[model samples]
Target: MRRRFAVLLAALALAGCSRLVETDQARLCRMALPALSPPDSTIEVVGQHEFPDGRGLRVVYQLEPPSPALTHFADCRFRQPGRPLRSDELTTLAIDGRPLSDVNLYFLVRFWLATPEARDADPAPLGDVADLPRLPRSAAYALQQALNGLPLAAIYALLAAAYSLVYGLVGRINLAFGDFAAAGGYAAALGALLAVGQTPATILAAALTLGGAAAAMWGIATSRWVFYPLRGATGQQALVASVGLAMAIDEFLRLAQGNRPVWVSPMLNAPFGVARAGDFVVTSALDALLSGGFALLAGLTLLAAMRFTRFGRRWRAYSDDPLAAQLFGVSPRAILAQTFALAGAFAGLSGFVMTIYYGSVGYAAATGLGLKALVAAILGGVGSIPGALLGGFLVGAFEAAWQACFSVDYRDVAVFSLLAITLALKPGGLFGVRS
Candidate 1:
């Protein structure tokens, strides 16, 4: 028994280590600031740009107030793709385009290991204005805000899709959509932590896989217990029960994790300087591009599948006439379960992007997020996927404009105001048919 237990422990340890490796390139990039300094002088990293192929990094930094030339940089070169350098393999170091002797490199490494930033390599940008294109002040500000808001829009769009899907099939809204998203956010953070390495590509893959799967499972369970019982009830009754379910999820998360926010360290948040107006500049990051692009791709793929597949035909048939679909041998419970699973998957993806882009997910984050998504669904035309997507972008853009032109305190108010206007004037959404 003792021997078998020992072997089990060893297997578990190896499994953990297999996924949590610190790659050679990640180690070198973490030491970017220290690599370019001698430990005696104060230096800070201003900008860091990775090579297209991921084997090289150009770190741009500056010395304290009085310096030799205002700016200096160091290029940390790595080996070819398959031949990654080991942690101890980096012997020679470069500082301000000059080679550092082995002796100096020794002290720098020791000092870096002692620093806080070295321990937590958060990818939050340190502001970049290098090589920014000239643009009018207003244009630059607008562009900057839009770049920041793009990811938020993607997140909203995804959550909105969840609401639309459920409403289209069941004639009821899932008020717990935000909590589902929050659950996905936590799962995604765990996925990143368990990734094979800190490389952007690998981490992204792990996060998406785990996050989407977890949320889909959560949705299935929710539909099983929560919505299944209410199938024979009125829509208002289901809506009220869903609201209660939302609160239950929130309380459960709060009690389980306490009040602390949970998330993985941000990675690849370095910005690309886009345009500038004097000292003011606009920047965007690859993180935002990946967020929006992946969301758009996922949304398009779902649309295509819905349009081209037999399953899509059945789903549409069920949505149009449940009695007819049942008469044709389609199961209502099965359809409902599948729809919830898909919605949960979208919500999970949204939460993953939110956590990755924003750096953390708090317990109460779901409340406001759910409210905004519900508004998006209603404004765009509830029960319509394309409408939800368009509504999400519009809401995101509106929030950006409000934050830029006015104070952010009333952003929610503005959004709710839009909801009121839409309901009062349009009644049915852009795609939703009027009763």
Candidate 2:
């Protein structure tokens, strides 16, 4: 038993090591920040001006403060002030080149203005042309916010849903699910390696296809050879095994990739810019690949399988009861193996998107993120497709709000808190109908 366990440990370790070839998107983002050395300058309203006609006026400023100049402000300021600005007159602020219709922008402006210096001083204002009513935002602003958060929300939702699917089918959470995400990335890296100077689309397709296949292979081997045989094992045993697997992967990745992260240039190099709204500057990209892309794909794949596929029927049967599924001429073992393969495929898809979106992959790429997905799965009701989707969106939106409302550091705390609250309120999760 000891030797067998040791062998199992080794295999799990190798699976974890594969993650070194592909890192998590979040890890990449954290890594990139230090390397990128993005310009230092919080978005702040420096000056606002009103046109003589009191009609429409253009506000201009550089997104990043120019270097070598003490205070980086675009020299495009009102050379001669003529119009008398009323104290009660409402003003709007625009960041970079974005319009003055963003809420975050406005909120930021309000916060900045609330400062002692801003309150006491009469800083130049941007727009005074129109006497706009202080009411709900125009449709344009709402559309922009929705579009801004859409892709991010979709990615998070996909991860959450994937977690729920695995948990629902396996009755156990896979801590290394994030590795699957990384796997797709590494697959892309491998594509980059193979494609060399090939077209971006060709390279991405290669990565997506091969990465997904590799992840599926890994999942099948691990599930059939290791986890499945240990099905009757205690939860503690399984948890330990999973953790051991995770550590083994981490160590292997460290050995293979060293301590450095690699970048994967985006397949679609969309020119993303900062949008200025009511008070904040937000990253906005018109050419951005919508978050719905993969979700729609996953949803369609799932719906099609559930509604039409024989494998889906077998899966549902096995999920209902392995013993009963086996008795009815279905092979539960085979079904389980296939299920792992399918789940791993989605994980690989996630990995590809992460690599493209974040631009790098690292050793601890998927660290702790899998757990977040698990929480979402629990919150949304494991095993239900809609539940997973709903839970993922909830988690993603919550995290986004947390990051926006508070510090980025506190995002995890908020997510975990929500998870805890959800569990306390509904142990079975929001959509869990099963007894």
Candidate 3:
């Protein structure tokens, strides 16, 4: 029994090692494709696996030209004898540019292997390959993409919630909310680096503290300097001021951090497969768990605070009717300041989680994230917290699904299309009360 267990463990370890090598070889093949092909050519890795002889590996890729008049199919085989693999004799198949056929093209490059050996081996097909195998691989890729999008959705949800909260209270959008998240991420990253010798728990605590404080300070500063002065002005004025403030914050960050991205150490980098079907695998179970867990906790906490806390009641009252709330002795200025501070804290925490999830933060973080969060807030109903959460997940899921079924470049188009449709059908969003 002991001997059998030991052999089983050894076999598993060897399998794992082999898989890692195959992955590395496939990545190399992908990296080499651009250099080997035309400048405008696009290469997609469809499938990769070790050859039946266990002495070589095969990587299948599809190359589509910019004109789409001809598609090239080729196989990259890396042999065990350490010989460099080349794809010199690729097969080019012509196809109509309009309504392309899904004929499931394949390319088999045997590298140094003889024609007989190549004939005997069956190589895995790439992503764009035809039916049967393509279904499972596409499904697996879609699942992985969805898992990737979850963290992004969670981050967007946090920002969306912040947006909804402030908008609910003040009836004005804070364009700088994304900047608050960026500030928090930077602050937390710096703090984590400073506390490198500390335990994980200690480092996390310090990061959260620093990030939240930095975001809160930024929120307060902006409110005092920008929004406060425009308190008596119209919503458009406040909106313009917030945009200017956001631009200034972005510029300041660019000046301070330079244009380079700063990488934060991942809290969890090890990925495990949650589901597998034959050669297709869906991984990153740990990442999905962490991202979903954090988002859920944050959402619930905010929900409870709003439902039961005194501050939440005042906020709701102000959101419902500011004049009435002011008549009822609720200090509008105090509520606005508190709302900004709370929203900033949420934004900061979002940044902290985003850094850990993505392992990096950059100046361009705000562009995609901010726009998505704004969409999420509007989708969920501008002032509804629950709606924001729902909207975020929907947006994330939609993006992933679009990438899976179609081109990733069209993901934003899909999202915006959905938004337009939703607005056209129900202008109040998924949760906002219709006036």
Which candidate tops lDDT? Answer: 1
* Residue-pair clashes per candidate: 0, 21, 3
Candidate structures ordered by TM-score, highest first: 1, 3, 2
Which is the winner by TM-score between candidate 1 and candidate 3?
Answer: 1
C-alpha local distance difference test of each model:
0.76, 0.56, 0.68
Candidate 1, 1-435: lDDT as tens digits: 466357435644443333322233444654556435455555655655555544555667676656563677766665443224344444445666786677766665566634566644423232335645688988888888898889988999899989999998888988999999998888888887786245566777788888888889989998999898899999899999999989998998899767999846565554546678898767765578667777788889888978999878888999999999999988988988999999999999999999888778876899899999989888889899888888888888889889989989998999999988989888677777665
Flag clash pairs in model 1: none
Which residue pairs does candidate 3 place in steric collision?
A: 46-126, 46-127, 47-126
TM-score of 1: 0.75
TM-score-superior candidate, 1 or 2: 1
Best by TM-score: 1
Model 3: weakest 10-residue lDDT segment is 93-102
Residue 292 Cα positional deviation in candidate 3, in Å, after optimal superposition:
1.7
lDDT of 2 by residue, 63-167 (tens): 244453332222111222212132112233332333344464345345543344443332212223132223233443544455555555565556666666656
TM-score comparison, 2 vs 3, better candidate = 3
> Which residue ranges in model 3 land beyond 4 Å of their true spot?
1-143
Error of 1 at 297 (Å): 1.2
lDDT-sorted candidate list, best first: 1, 3, 2
Where model 1 places Cα greater than 4 Å from the true spot, the runs are: 1-132
